[model samples]
Target: TNASPSNTQTPEHSPTTIAVVKGLAWLFGSGSKTSTAIRETRTAYDLCAKRDNEESKFIHEVCRLSPTYQTWFQIANLHVWMVRTRYRALPAPYGKAFEQEFVNHFFLDIEDRMRAALNHKAPERIVKGYLTEMRDQWMGATFSFDLGLVGSDAELSGAIWRNLFASRGLDGKGELIGKPGKIGESRAVADGKAALAELPFHLYVFSAYIRRELKRLESISDEDVMAG
Candidate 1:
């Protein structure tokens, strides 16, 4: 006897995939407060972009080269720093755990959006690997900046320059490449101090934005658990 069509079942979506989809939907939804924060952040970036300084030129170049990835990296770096600083008052272990969870969720949502935008689907293993690498990048950035904080402003500027521009040698595409032109790098280094000067204020705004989003998510999760 032939098997019935009911015997053929489609695979269910993974919890991570479902959560990412839902999270992104909520994040960009029409009435989302989170969307407001995102818009404000973009507005800040836009204002920064309008300047004709060397720092602005560097920012524009990176955005021009790899808009999506560069933009995501900048936001993620700030968010991770905010998480680390915010949780510093907690015990060491708990602080580390909270940072990891926050970073994981942030990257997951980023990956989902990236896949959607590119019209690509990666295997679970591949997705996990990407997440692992991204987490490592976050930790590396934190450690690098921590050291920079103890050193001179020049050291901090070097760290920022490396993270923002020098770290990735790739062009707009994913291919390997050399450093940016000498003139650009020279101008960037000269402008770096001024740019770094503005970061503390921006960081404060970003931290508040991130904290509000996290509390909003926690409240939703609490409501779901209670309803369940």
Candidate 2:
């Protein structure tokens, strides 16, 4: 008629088991935070990479850039760089990890584009060579822009001019190639001159956009950013 005494006792964990459980939690906790941060990086990248969106339209048509892969990269990379600055505002590990993961996605996307642009089955080294050059370009742009952020608006404008507006002259067929015809030579020269003349204005407008976006990002809820 009596109940067993062991049934009334609570199960207890040994010191070793408790320690192991704590250690495993730490491991997975760190990994999960990083994984969440990495997952959001794609959304951040898409902010610049989404096709024919307002950002792309402004870069291509209004800014007079040809719709080449290079132009797209410049646009994508510029926004990536901008958002990274704000990422620094996030708490320690998440901020650094997010910035790095965002960059990782950008380059991965670039490599895919390069493969398609060249032969789909292009040699790894060939695609890597282009990627190496791109890495250098990106490093230079970010360094210059970082200096610009701490300096003046003029400095930022100069950085944009050197990077984003560095798109090459395009031909009639929208290729960054071909020679001008007899009649076309005059038109090309005139167009080039006009573009040059408008360069200062566009640079100013782009600088404004950069400044505005950076400010706007600062205003967004941390929840939305962390959801990345």
Candidate 3:
């Protein structure tokens, strides 16, 4: 049957509209490939939380001081540094190319999630600033561990204590306080030594978890899927 001109006309989406829709879907879609990255990151957090011993006491305390989201960020930063250091120390089987690709995608996915969660576009300057700060922290952490690696046990302990406490010692009641006195300082040093004693085992566990997750990520067939 013949229809009126208006009834027969079909609406077509403009290229701009199509691109915007696709971009939105890519950004906020439920079936995003970034889901895997996010899941694995949460698993890392779970790994940190599951350890309940002297080896993990410092981590637990740090996590306790922050809210859940902040703890996740802290864990993510530490994991990123640990993974990078591990790969650098012992080259990955897939080589540096794959390592670089994976790390790049990991943070890109994290940034996307952050933007979506905030429900607003973050300024490029601000994002770059944060990335720079994170990089600085990563380098600082690597340098601290390097010093520990080559130095005496006391040096290693001191490094650990400085990092965990951020140079501010905690009181007996777990309250954050100023620099410790002589006896308090001694106690903190002793605590660091105890933690350092178990650092090797803790690092082993951390390395294993990250390696497993990264391998899982590497197994993704579509490289572009993770390139977000």
Candidate 4:
């Protein structure tokens, strides 16, 4: 997906830009020190706050351009997830302040748009369902964070698999298929689309959480997976 260029550019010929382009080149077909540095820096963050920013931005773009029922749900869910996990990590008053800033800048406006999309009965259930998904993602995020703090590869891998599977909405019984909705709708069913539309937000959050978790695992410095 083409990310709309930010009004703020890192400078076309500057180190960051050169590094990003070169890093993409390597990511597509090779490897390099710059790419490694980028990976390591991302690993250093608890999760990719940057990627969260991008995902939030992408959802906003979708909301603005397509504002479908599903896109509205997606945008709303992503905002809620950001508030729970990434926003929680910010320091002191700065965290709350930054979170409010994001809401004011993007999410609050999206909420209004979503409200307009809802029929006679406000889609409170849809919003609540998205919140539930956020809660689950936060739980998985915490699990991953703990794994990093403890530096346990076994725990990390196991937790990652569990998180990934659960995020997909499967259960031990194999009866629960697809992500949960606020109301009793299934993404599997046609009417479930209204319910599932915002589900991509949950998927997006989980994927970001997992990516950060894997990077944390890789940055563990001395873990030898083969030795296990």
Q: TM-scores across all candidates?
A: 0.43, 0.73, 0.41, 0.30
Candidate 2 residues 1-228, lDDT tens each? 011112233223233334433443453244346677667877878766764345656766666765556666677788888888887788776776677666766665665565555435555555555666677788899899899888899999888877776632433222223224211111222366567667778889988888898999999877788885
Can you write out model 1's per-residue Cα lDDT over 1-228, one digit (the tens) per residue? 111112333334345555554654443332323333343334333322223232333344533223334344544465455434544434444434343344434554445443443334566765545445555665677786666555655555555545544433223232223334211122222334444454444344433444565455445442232222
Decide which is better by lDDT, 2 or 3. 2
Q: Count the backbone clashes (under 3 Å) in each candidate.
A: 0, 1, 0, 1
Candidates arranged by lDDT, highest first: 2, 1, 3, 4
**C-alpha lDDT values of all predictions:** 0.42, 0.63, 0.41, 0.37
| TM-score of model number 1 | 0.43
> How much is 86 displaced in model 1, in angstroms?
2.6
Give the poorly placed runs of model 2, Cα more than 4 Å off. 1-32, 51-53, 167-190
Deviation from native of the Cα of residue 137 in model 4, angstroms: 6.2
Among the numbered candidates, top TM-score falls to: 2
Tell me which residue pairs clash in candidate 1.
Answer: none
Candidate 4 residue pairs in backbone clash: 74-198
Our tally of clashes for model 2 stands at 1
The true-versus-predicted C-alpha distance at residue 89 of model 3, in Å, is 4.8
lDDT of 3: 0.41
The per-residue C-alpha lDDT of model 4 at residue 129 equals: 48
Instruction: Summarize candidate 3's per-residue lDDT along 165-186 as a digit string, tens digits.
Output: 4443343333323334211121
Model 4 lDDT tens row, 47-70: 322333456555333322122333
The parts of candidate 3 lying over 4 Å away from their true place are 1-63, 68-70, 89-94, 113-121, 157-165, 170-228
